[model samples]
Target chain A: MSLVTDKIISKPKIETRDLGLEMTENNRSLIEISNFDFFYGEKQALFDVSMDIKEREVTAFIGPSGCGKSTLLRCINRMNDLIEVARIGSGKITVNGVDIYDDRVDTIELRKRVGMVFQKSNPFPKSIYENVVYGLRIQGITRKSKLDEAVERCLKGAALWEEVKDRLDTSGLSLSGGQQQRLCIARALAVEPDILLMDEPCSALDPVATAKVEELIHTLKDRYTIVIVTHNMQQAARVSDRTAFFYLGKLIEMNATDQIFMSPDKEQTEAYISGRFG
Target chain B: MKRYFHEELEEIRSHLMLMGEKAVESVKLAMQALLESDIELANQVMESDDVIDDIEKQIDDEVVRYVSLRAPVARDLRLLFVAIKASHDLERVGDEASNIAGRTKKILAQGLPIDAVARVPRMCELAINMLEDSLRSFIQEEESLAYSIVGRDREVDTLNRENFKELVELMKSDSANVSACTEMVFISKSFERIADHAKNIAEEVFYLLTAQSLKEVTRGK
Candidate 1:
């Protein structure tokens, strides 16, 4: 056979540091954390963590136990204020070009714009319709037709309207585990929050239910900036656009979910994915 | 931590080397038998073909088991995949060796004067050397050496074509030697096939080392 002599073009090597950096100034992130640090009393939790959460994209936080993934999630909505010893120092968290922690910033107004769903589905024992309209009612929306419309819109947005529409008068606790979680999501959306934080939202559910919750998260990203904290590596892989890996209160690496799952830049991330000592 | 994966890989390599050595030895014996008209040595090469067939089956089984169990990806998977292809080519090379041996037996039984025997022995030697080099390149993971072997295949094709024309002239010049010349033609065809198998081995070696399709690379050029 005659030998062919074409030159092969090789791909250029990209440095790890160059990845995940937003190159253009015009595409500024919706949420930006600049050298953020957190402390519980004298014990520090997060150290010089800085990253961006882009607008309308799902960003997943993953790490081993006690690595501050949940703590970091709570810091976004100032949920750490519930803890007596919690303190944030040395950095700033800004959403839509404004700092939420400023002295003049209103915590109540900030919470209305940043809603959250907990690990467990902690629905109120009240009726399903009351649970969904609870946030709107607290905002002083008392008109019956407005509350009814908001309830329908938010339930459909959470992908739970069809199942609970006939049972609007039933107790929120009467629904299954997966439906209750979606009820919690619908409650979070009832406030019309710009950013939604989920802390292991599917950890308590089975695989089939978890798939439904994951699908809901994907649908929610069209209108809201979503940040999720999950211990399940495969769940993060299947849902998130970008993933951040935290270890020992430090942000080890963050990149596109595909890169983190297939070939992570950090050795720790690789070890975790390969099932070699988390 | 399974030892069987690495052990099977090493076992496959050893069997390939043994088969390669047998093919070289068969060609050498066939050439010697042709020069001395030793029908006995020619018959010995033909009778030993069963051993080559048995080794081919063994290699095939080892490759299939490793692939089904390991499900290896990237370089490890490429090596196992190429091992399967190389095993088939080596089996065909064994078949070519047997054909050469059978032709040597026929020419010896006829007791005819072989005019093209000199060129035939040189072609056989070149084919055997190429096979040996291709295996060495695989064992060493030398991609450059593999590419060089692939580049040299055209030389073997040229030698086969030249020998075919010269053998035809011998048959036309002496009508009584038609049967022997026909056997010589078969021997030349066997050498050509052996060269082709060596070229295949080289291509597989290149693929196993680089994870690039050799056919695509050559075609792109």
Candidate 2:
């Protein structure tokens, strides 16, 4: 109990970013949550969670089942708003310094800038080309050249273009499970979201398919900040630059991925990583 | 839920412990043979080498299977990696013990004065002690114990150097004792390597426990 191993890297202060005195990447807090709490009707699911998701970096959340990792990711782009029982209790979550839970913040608009991919590949039954551009079409982008370009670019971004380019007219459901997941990722990318949240994107795919997604994640972080929630600890270690460990609704630790995997600071982190946690 | 994965890790630990005891015993027995000139004991140490090798081979295979199955992370990860390297070091330690015993075979055949070769056994005692402590340090996950074990490496090294000097002086003064002196030097060198292997395991234990290399830590006097 006396071992103080929680040697996480310190978060940057908001004032430092505002004043422009500490403008280094280490001091950048792309998404900041301060003392945030959430509830599902009577039961509180998150307790005073405060952490930063840096710009253009993949931050993975890992923990046991029902540890609120998915719950926390849902709160980022207001994905939990669909659940009638869910409610935000207190505190502030700011993306680009604007409080997301504010009254004027449209959930739909917020989701546009923060794309998401789910555990299952939920690609629409529409054709693969249509699935890629479905978001843009709904937003009223109708130009043939624009939709065609978006389809090409996003499919390539997901690394599915070469395999599916000749079959663009085929139903999205016709593709293999891994390819369908990549199609969902392309759909998410078509919106040009600054932040992408993935809730166990590779959970349903085989190892070969999983590797493609992980490799895609590695490249996607250069243009968009990504946060992933995965129970797969090795996948989290492989793709993310930083890792956050959550347990029992609390943010236990956040650190560089290697540090988290090789020599984490918290005993709970150690226990979880070592498969000793009960 | 207690997964079978944790059980696999425990199995690897137990096997490593068994190998540790064998490695330590090999050195002890070989040292005894060197001091007492018991060719039979020397032969026993040599013959037991395969048992030590087999234990290491078993642990190596178990570690590989554990990693392939669990893909262990953090401390479990460090434990697997350290287990692999430490097993290799333990195997080499066994080989050195056998090497020392092999040299003792020659000394017995030549009928040399065991006194001139006596200091090497004294050095083996420190090396054996270090190896024993290194194994304990790993089993207990004691960083401080491993560090203390690392610091003792210098002592064994110093004794090996001094022992080598004494044997060289004996060889230079008496041409007839040259053959036995040559075997004594080889034994002294093997003892130094055994001490090094012990230090390697201790450093590995430090890494396994603290997740920091012991050499990086500022040692105390």
Give the candidate number with the greatest DockQ: 2
User: How close is every model to the real structure, measured as TM-score?
Assistant: 0.54, 0.57
Interface RMSD for every prediction, one decimal? 14.0, 9.5
Q: Candidate 1 on A1-278: residue-level lDDT in tens?
A: 11110111122323212222223233347788889999999999999899998878889999999899999999887777777788897898987766666654555556667799999999999999999999888879999999999999999999899999998999999999999999999999998887899999999998778878888887888788899999887778767888999998899999987678766899998887667964
Docking class of 2: incorrect
Estimate, for each residue in B4-41, the C-alpha lDDT of model 2 and write its tens digit: 24777899899899999988888999988877878999
Interface RMSD against the true structure, candidate 2: 9.5
Kindly state the fnat score of candidate 1.
0.00
TM-score of 2: 0.57
Question: Model 1, stretches more than 4 Å misplaced?
Answer: A1-28, B1-221
RMSD of 2: 16.0
